[model samples]
Target: MDRQKYTIALLGGTGAEGSGIALRLARAGHRVIIGSRDADKAARACSELAGLAPGAALSHDANPEAAAAAQIVIMTVPHAGQQKTVQEVREQLAGKILVDATVPLVPPKVARVQLPEGGSAVAAVQRLLGDAVRVVSAFQNVSAHHLRDLAHVPDCDVLVCGDDPEARETVVGLAADMGLRAWHAGAIANSAATEALTSLLIAMNMRYKVPGGTGIRITGLEETAEARRT
Candidate 1:
């Protein structure tokens, strides 16, 4: 699980999804930095995570600093705050991989698919960041509830989408390190599909009364030899 360890930062790391991801990354032996608008809140979250996974090499900082320090930065903020958060860290994110887990779920009608004007949220981020930053889309469909429960292996796979093959594969590896099967799901534009699935999954969760939330899985594909290395 510790293969090619990296210093990863979780922007908006004080949130539920961000905390869960931070825990898993720390457990995978990556140097995990929890980032938040409030530096104190970020540190508190790190302390709590350190208690949950002792000696996990966890730390915290304000979002901008976290982005500057890490090789890879993940945005776990809500759709409403996505643009602002990315803009705040834009300078720091240059020449680094920005993993965006943003889902466009307009409140009150969250179960209904509500894509942004540009068709894909990650694509917008990519355009905003330009070519210097490799923006990869992922984790929009993963259940944050199950992610926090380390004992439970999530019964779902991750669909990683990015224009850059190397950056996309890097995220696939990170997902694997977190103990979940991940696949390269074409380019970042395909993120619209994955983002929409979150709403569909939410609808299903309510209809089926699934407590931990529903997730998507890809069937029938065998792992390639290269995938096995990661």
Candidate 2:
């Protein structure tokens, strides 16, 4: 299958994860719109990214406008702000894929896994967005710092979870485009496992002092046809 190109709206694109992913997406030849509550901040981020990758298609807009313009919307906001950002763009997100990268890590005790009432951050987003929008959860285990440093390939596997099979495949392809291996980790509800794994990784980072960042990779499947093809 030919990789489907998408105009992606990155909500909270002024932040670390959002900007890092935006940079990768832009470099991969996808049109990226940095979306933020502050349009100026989004524009500034876009400018900085443009400098990093000379001729990439990068732009900015307020959350609503960006969401409206894009075919795929990625939510990278903190857990506290995820709902508000999602609500802001709710109307514009219908019939689109919304990749939820929000992990529920209550600060100070961020090392201790803390899942929301709905099981995971993505679950809450799915509830808020309803059936009109397809929600795929991923990137919780990735290090934003690693993503920003395009020179180094991240040694991590992205666990993509979504109720919709096609949506999951789309996000997996996006992760692959960024040079990261991704696996379909079943339905959106399974996102809780991946989200909780972030805290475990944080704990491991501090406990063992892994410099850049620690990541997870699935093993024992090297002989599979899918793995061989990749």
Candidate 3:
């Protein structure tokens, strides 16, 4: 199957995770718009990313404008700012796919699993944006450091979860474009597991003192038809 290109807006794109994903998507021939609370910050990020991936389509705007211009919107802000960022673009996000990569990791004890009252960050986004927007949760386990260094293909699998199967598949395709295997991990409710896994990976990174990013890979099902379909 041919890869489907998209105009993706990365909210909080000035940050490491958002900018890294934007660079990868742009390098894969997608038009990427870096969005941030400050337009100047977004522009600076776009400029820096363009240097890394020359000739890749890249642009920048405020969060609302970027969200309105893109086919898909990804929120990569820290857990504390997720709600505010999503709320700013909620109106522009109707009838679009909003990829929530925000993991609820309360700082001081980030390594410890500490999910919000709603179970996961994705669920909270769903409640805020309602059904009009397809909120797919993913990219929680991958590391920003690894994503920024595009020289090496990541040794990780993205666990995508969403209420809509088609939405999940679309995100899986995006992951594939970044050279990572992605799987449909059931409904949006299942996002809790992946979100919690980020904390575990953080703990492991500290425990083992792994300089590079430590990630997870699903084994024993590589040959499955379903896996290939993704």
TM-score of decoy 1: 0.96
lDDT of 3 at 110: 93
| Model 1: CA > 4 A from native | 223-230
The alpha-carbon lDDT assigned to residue 60 of candidate 3 equals 92
lDDT of 1 by residue, 11-66 (tens): 98889889998999899899999988787788889999999899899999888999
Colliding pairs, model 2: none
Tens-place lDDT per residue, model 2, 1-230, is 35777899999899998999999999999999999888778888999999988899999988899999999999999999988888899999999999999989999899999898878889878887789999999998999989999998999999999999999989989998888888989999999999999999999999999978899999987688766554
Error of 2 at 173 (Å): 0.5
Global local distance difference test of model 1: 0.91
Model 3 steric clash pairs: none
Off by over 4 Å in 3: none
Q: How close is candidate 2 to the true structure, as a TM-score?
A: 0.97
Q: How high is the CA lDDT of each candidate model?
A: 0.91, 0.91, 0.91
Ranked by TM-score from best down, the candidates are 3, 2, 1
What TM-score does each of the candidates earn?
0.96, 0.97, 0.97
Error of 2 at 207 (Å): 1.0
